[model samples]
Target: MAKEVYQNRIELLQGTLDLLILETLRWGAQHGYGISHAIRARSGEVLQVETGSLYPALHRLERQKWIASQWRLTEQNQRAKFYELTTAGKEQLVRDRSKWEAMVQAIAGVLGPVPEPEA
Candidate 1:
């Protein structure tokens, strides 16, 4: 029952995961687990990225040359692949951020501020 509820949970928009992953890497290189944790933490735990989406997105970004990955030892002395944003990724981040800002503004305009409670 619990698993079913989790499986039915809403996820990030179709392509927003790419932008979020790129944004997280802006800080520096991070392994897959670290990236997911960072996204959840930064979003105040509101967003939980499923591995099913994360690995594929990471691979897609790597193929697009937006991010590069290499194997390294973690603080735990374990081997892991760390991904870092490339120059192109940085540029894409700026573009994505601009689009996101515009999107938020448009949505806000539609929703409008809550009118003060009818006196």
Candidate 2:
């Protein structure tokens, strides 16, 4: 059952990770673990952002100057790097969201409505 549930998860595309990370940071500054938790919670467990993918995205976003990070102690008193969106990141979020919405609409159009089940 757990394996089936795990298998149902969706894998994120290359650009989508950056968008999700930026949107997650929009709420406020968060450590890497916190960021992943927030995304999983918000996605209702359907989207699991793996650490392998998450860290590289974090580093890339940092290099892009879309987010800034600082070392901070978590609630558990453990030290971690917290990241927050920069002004440019906020702008990028807006742009990415627009593109995402448009892509969703385009895909939906191509797929059309779902067929009804037979009685």
Candidate 3:
């Protein structure tokens, strides 16, 4: 059904919001809403990040010094906090990506051919 297909379109982000946010900021500084839109747009509208998750991750990244933020006015003149990746964030992103690739490979290995039962 169309509803089932729509449900399938959304997937659990599974602790990757940090990586996603970091990756998103790589392009340039953006406000919170802008970051969310960018991620959804990039993911073909499948990865819809909720505000409850997004803001906390942003703050956590800020505390960890992986990202930096500043209050800025949008084109519409609304005040919002814009986040950008730091030097440390860039390095961390590289590490995260390596880890992600390793995880995918490991899962793929587990999903590969099963051994035949001994007689």
Cα lDDT listed for each candidate: 0.90, 0.92, 0.90
Clashing pairs in 1: none
TM-score of 1: 0.83
The clash count of every prediction, one per candidate, is: 0, 0, 0
Q: Which stretches of candidate 2 lie over 4 Å from their true place?
A: 1-12, 114-119
Write the residue-wise lDDT of candidate 1 on 31-115 in tens digits.
Answer: 9999999999999999999999899999989998999999999999999999999999999889888887898898998899777
Better structure of 2 and 3 per TM-score: 2
* lDDT by residue (tens digit), candidate 3, 25-96: 999999999999999999999999999989988998999999999999998999989999999999999998
Model 2, 1-119: lDDT tens per residue?
88765554433366799999999999999999999999999999988999999999999999999999999999999999999999999999999999989989989988998878999
* Candidates ranked, most accurate by TM-score first: 2, 1, 3
Q: Residue 111 of candidate 2: its Cα lDDT?
A: 96
Model 1 Cα shift for residue 47 (angstroms): 0.4
Error of 2 at 20 (Å): 0.5
Q: How accurate is candidate 2 locally (lDDT)?
A: 0.92
Candidate 1 local lDDT, residue 61: 91
What does the lDDT read for residue 109 in candidate 1? 86
Spell out the clash pairs found in candidate 3: none
- Name the candidate that leads on lDDT: 2
